[model samples]
Target: MEELKEELLSTDGKLDFAIGFKGTVAIGFQSPQSGYNLKVIRNTPTEQYKWGVFEGVPSVLEKYGRVHVINRTGSMLDNIIFYRVKLERAWFTNALLQELLNDASECVTLQGESLFFRHLIVQSKLIPLPVYLENSSQAESEAAIINLGHCIKNNMAANIFNKDLDARNYGVGVFGGVYLFDYDALEQFTEVKIRTNQNQFEGEEDIPEWFFEDGVIFLPEEIESGLRIPNRSLRQLFREVHGDLLQVDYYERIQDELGVGKVPSARVYPERYQIN
Candidate 1:
């Protein structure tokens, strides 16, 4: 079966023009009733390559069912590309994706060259967890953190890992569950040994003493460092529920699971990705 369709986008899907980066993914419309905000991928070879890598990622995510992921993607005139997934929105919805299918609705219009389409758009109504945790109760924070652990476990069980495992890369979905949205560093580890920090600390030595394996990155230690939030209590709460992720034993169980009989269906990916 063919993996990608060669159909020409209505025009914007081609992304022949650059988009303005003046705004972050956060949604802020001048009116409360303003139509949905779009997150367009800048027209650049780098973004195109990155976006290309994500072509089938959403399909894989859809099978996970409960996981929040980008919803749909396609192109319009000018080769502009767009995704039903907005980088930032007050709420997540699948309307954008479905709208694209209705030729009569004019869900979006290509007014000029400054905007493009996003095949990387999503249908998640969840907000970023870190931002939510900042204004929420300790209970909420703990729940988010715990749910995050669940999210990680579920994804890993499916044989995938987010190398950039940062808190911002994840979001709390409309269902009150945390899910990952970023794919810039997604990878598989069907046989890769999880990387761990060496027992020694970094000192005057030029090279950091962290351990390294052939192609896999140990994610536990990095999670503690990268996913840690600013709130003291939230961090403490996460420690209570997921402190194991910072240790080797946490990964040992996964390693053992894979060794015994876990289906090794994932393709082994390189530790580093090279853009050619």
Candidate 2:
């Protein structure tokens, strides 16, 4: 983490162009000493990336002073590049923050259960996105709608479930609501499947039978292979930062909703199944 900080600081004032998807280029920070403020100047897929930036909000400016520079990291399974940077402000206020913190606290208190959770943190809150509510009478409702819309527009649903969703990757302002940063994981999907024919599957064959008998035959695989499975090292880091909050069973219901076993090729929906 220190190394990442150092790298960010070193590129403070400089601006450099980094290639992203086929025709896109991200404007990146040249040096870290310049302080928090970042921007992605260019993008492809019909300029959808620009909407991630909220427009006309004072609180956002009060928080993160300027649009310093953007930093492009690598791509995730979803093909969106990740970038880590610092911002001017230390914190911001929002209902989402309170809810998230409460959830985190509850997860920590309910330890000892076998559950799966993701660890994400607010590195900085000063850098605000340019989102605002058009309906003054319905500020809260507008905020929720915009935030949810932004999440869906940027393919964040996949990342959120996958546990790779970074708070810095999205932000909520006073009446402006949520704005998305980092477009890397947008539109990516990960599927889990049970391997039934492998040579090592002899003893595991019964697992599928049990899952099918239990009416969970739609689930592709166990939590181990889920799209958001946290790496052992990352999990350890989460435990250190957020304690038992990283051990909650947030995905259990979703997993159950998806079912427990893989659908046989012959039985899969014709539109979804591919023939080799």
Q: TM-score winner among the candidates?
A: 1
Candidate with top lDDT is: 1
Question: How far out, in Å, is residue 218 in model 1?
Answer: 2.4
Worst 10 residues of 1 by lDDT: 71-80
For residues 56-121, write the lDDT of model 2, one tens digit per residue: 223222222222122111111111212332232212123322322343332212223311112222
TM-score of 2: 0.23
Query: TM-score for each prediction?
Result: 0.54, 0.23
Off by over 4 Å in 1: 1-40, 43-120, 191-193, 201-214, 263-276
Candidate 1, number of clashes: 32
